[model samples]
Target chain A: MLTAHKIKVFQSLDKKKFRQKYNLFLVEGNKTIKEIPNSHFKIREIFSLDPSEIPTGDFDTTKITPKDLKKISFLQHPKDSVAVCELGEEKFLANLPIQIVLDGIQDPGNLGTIIRLADWFGIPQIICSEDTVDLYNPKVIQASMGSFLRVNVVYRDLVEYLTHSDAAKIGTDMDGENLYHHKFPEKFNLILGNEGNGMRPETERLLTEKITIPRFGKSTESLNVSMATGIILGQIFSHKG
Target chain B: MLTAHKIKVFQSLDKKKFRQKYNLFLVEGNKTIKEIPNSHFKIREIFSLDPSEIPTGDFDTTKITPKDLKKISFLQHPKDSVAVCELGEEKFLANLPIQIVLDGIQDPGNLGTIIRLADWFGIPQIICSEDTVDLYNPKVIQASMGSFLRVNVVYRDLVEYLTHSDAAKIGTDMDGENLYHHKFPEKFNLILGNEGNGMRPETERLLTEKITIPRFGKSTESLNVSMATGIILGQIFSHKG
Candidate 1:
């Protein structure tokens, strides 16, 4: 039985302030709920309209009515299950072969897609500037499609992080060396910027090198940042083969 | 002069049946509206909250109040400028080095992103299955970020189009040649499938070859359709260099 207080708490998870206050985040959709047990995340509570939709686990689940579910669901088409997950302590694991650094990616979808791409390329960690979209944003989690469980994303001062890194700090620019010809170092930090503005001027100053995806067409001004990340990662991994 | 009937028509363009009845589409945002004069599509009308926001061209602009713009706007936050563009006759230009084919794609954002990727790589055309999301969806236009002005996307019966084409019909699958190793033909049709179900069995049968992006990670089941397209296109273009 979900009390009005519990409902209010679940609804609060949608905002970053509330999520940070409670140290909990929302995860909806039956498939994603099932994935939580295998990940490092701890599920504080699970609510489902249908009991069967809840994953087979030792955790307790509260069966809620459709009306109650509607009040707490974030999706336009709400799924059968929703979980309140405890935020894990993120560790910045340094010295990886390829570490993705996000300068200020504002779009939840773009951040989510980048996390998925990082997981696909077997990148274990991502370091983001403090201004980047919150990793626990419901849209980001939805777009990530469970890859958030595998990849570790930690927020830090980009200037401080880049300054301490001994590895190559590569930032993308339109006028930089062609990505096709640029050779990535064995250990490098690949930094992506915001959706509208590229990287912040201060952040761009720390770059050890700059690279670009050469445009084949005449009119398009730029590729979507997430698409650019995927294209660049594809080139990097193909060299290993 | 803005009239009530004109508002109804503009609002109606958000739906497919109404857009087809009028043979028109909505292009919003000041930046996207500016690109209209250079494209092949004709502007039926331009309405802007500020006349100065309208693109400088031989076209006439009708100044309207924000309240009037709100009724016809499809976005959450309405832009100053909106234009009704006439739908152009899309031509299927075959015998190109590479063409993109979308099979039952449902998301407008994915469609838009793919169109942008196609524009970035200089791929002129995208062939879509009849059931794919309509190209004129407001979300598709917004997500595309103006690439729709340059690329031609046409809807057709996949079986008929694939059967008639002499070029290699390539599909992506897990059990397939690693994209790093696959050699794409000079003239080929690259088909991306539905977000949830992937290619229909009938559609999959028409493929002349299958290629897969080798996953370096174990958890991610797959990449987003648009992201995969970018990764593959990146590989294809790098070989050209």
Candidate 2:
């Protein structure tokens, strides 16, 4: 049975302050919760209408009523389950051929979609600037579609990281070389910027090279940052030169 | 000056039934509203805190208080302006080298992003299945970032449109030819299915070719529909033969 005080604590997880203070985050939906068993992230508790709906795991499952579940759900339509998960240990950047570096990305959905894109292209990690949206945000978790379980996301001071990394730092910019003709370095970091404003000036200064997605039409000023990331990643992973 | 009755009517446009009944929809944000003058859509009225915020246009601008604007605004944080635009004249599909076909897309943001992608790739039109989400959804208007002005989105019976068009109908699927290796026809229709469920079985039966974005990672089952559209379009429009 869920106590009134417990519901208050669960609801507070929606905000970053509470999520950080308690060292826990919320993950919803059966598909996402089912993947928890195999990941390094620990589950503190799982609330579900039916125990069978949750994957067999060591996590404690609490039976919840639909009405009570609605009180803690962050979604418009609450799913079958909501899990309170313990944050995993911070991971440092690993040496890899291709890595995605995000600078000041504000939207939770964009961050999540980029994480999923990374998973699709088999990129093992995402390095984010400290000011980027928190990975533990519930919206990011929902949008990542459980791909967060597979990809490692690390946060650091971007200037410090970019300055130290030996890999070529490639930022997306309008005046940069055409993506079609540009030769991508085998070992490089693909950097993406903010939505409304492009990359910060300090971050832009660190790029060793820049690339642009040539526009076929003049009507659109720019593609959504997450959509642009997907397109760029697809081109990078394609068999064609 | 905004009247209470008028404010009620503007707020009502948030619902599809009311928007259709009034034959008008809301487009928020200064950036989106600025694109209105060049498009076929007619602006019935513009509401903003400052008349100067409205683009120089034939439309009438009404000065509204920020407090009053909150009542009619659909966004959690409303932009500088909102335009009540009349639905444009429905345009039939024109013969084009490439077109996008969406089957039962229920998400407003996906429809909007696909429209933006079509604009980015120079794809002039998107033909949608009858059951697809309404194009005039406020969330779609917000997400498209004004690209809706450039692309034509038409809804029709999928089976009928696919059968009637002489161009090749290409559907995205897992068992299909690898996207990099697949030869895109000069004149073809790119079909994308619903998010949770794949395309309707009837819609699948009409495709002349099938292609897939090969997965490099085993963790992700699928990409978001809009992300998939962007990736596929990037390949189709690239300089590579």
Candidate 3:
């Protein structure tokens, strides 16, 4: 059973400041818990409604009732399980392959999807502008589907990262070098934009190249920002040795 | 000002049956409304707090109090305006370079993102199984941007569309051929799957060839279904044409 203090602490982790202070985040649901065993993330505390909630594990566990589960749950109905995991320490890129940098992705789900895609194509890491969504938002943790464990994601000022880094920075745009026609750079930092309006012009100015996925028909002006990440990552994976 | 009876009818659009009965759907916010102009969708009614709600056009408009907007609004806080759009008639693949079939995609957001990506790629039609989400869900409408206008999406049984259609149905899966080496067919029906699980087994059985985007590094077993669509569609668009 959870106390009011526990619920308050769980809810506070939803905020970026609290997440940063604690160096922890939470992921809920059966799918997310299952992915944790194979992920790079470390488990902190797990509270479950069912004995079978988490697959057999050595992590510290607390069996609790559904009412207890509700206190920590962000969803309308509390999930069967909840796990607090240690956020992976931020890492600097070395012998880097293709990397992804997010300028101002505000939507937590989109940010989570970006992390999941980065995990899939094996992009070395993701660097986010300070304005990016909080990694610990339960929505992001759920959306990431455990890719958060595998991908090295960090939030830092973009101007500082790009100004000092030698990696070729590619920005996606509707009108630019056709991604298909453009040569995949050996070392590149791909930048995606905000969920609504894309990269601020100042950020766009820092980009060394602007590439676009060529549109074949009369359809959407731009793909979802996360979709852009998948397209770019998949293509880069295809070209890598 | 809008009438209480009229507001009650509009609010009912939150349900599938209600949307079907009215043959109308809701479009929220100014950006979504702006995307609709020059789109294939038709505006049935426009509701906003201000007469200047929409960008201004030849449509019949109704100015409603913010209270009325809140009564029928899907958003947490009502936007300045929401438009009721005429749902397009069921469309078929008349002339298509490529088409997509969503086997059992139940999430409105995924379905919307797929439609938006298909729209950007100029893929004309999407045939969904009957159980798929209502394209009119405010969530779907919001996520699709205005691509729902350009994309012709229809709902039919899974087996029916694949059985009658001559397009080579290629389904994505784990055991399939690596997409990197898979030859692109001229006429293909690219199939995406549900979020939690991969394709339905029977759907996988009907696939001409199961295909996968190869993983370049140590990573999760698969890609998100929506991410897979972008990778495959990007390949199709980038294919030598």
Give the candidate number with the greatest TM-score.
1
The digit string of per-residue lDDT tens for model 3 on A122-191 reads 6768888988887778788778877777777888889888887798988988788988888877787888
Model 2 misplacement above 4 A: none
- Report the candidate with higher DockQ, 1 versus 3: 1
Docking class of 3: medium
Alpha carbon lDDT of residue A129, candidate 1? 96
> Which runs of model 1 end up more than 4 angstroms from their true locations?
A56-58, B56-58
List model 2 lDDT by residue over A80-131, tens digit each. 9899899889986578999899999999999999999898888889999999
How would the candidate models be sorted by DockQ, starting from the highest? 1, 2, 3
lDDT of 2 by residue, B2-85 (tens): 788888888888688988888999888777788888888889889998879678677789888888779889899887888889
Alpha carbon deviation, residue A147, candidate 1 (Å): 1.1
Cα TM-score of candidate 3: 0.91
lDDT at position B76, candidate 1: 90
Candidate 3 chain B lDDT trough over 10 residues, lowest sum:
B90-99
Q: Lowest summed lDDT over 10 consecutive residues: which window, candidate 3 chain A?
A: A232-241
- The deviation in Å at residue B161 for candidate 3 is 2.7
What CAPRI class is candidate 1? medium
Highest lDDT: give the candidate number.
1
lDDT of each: 0.89, 0.88, 0.80
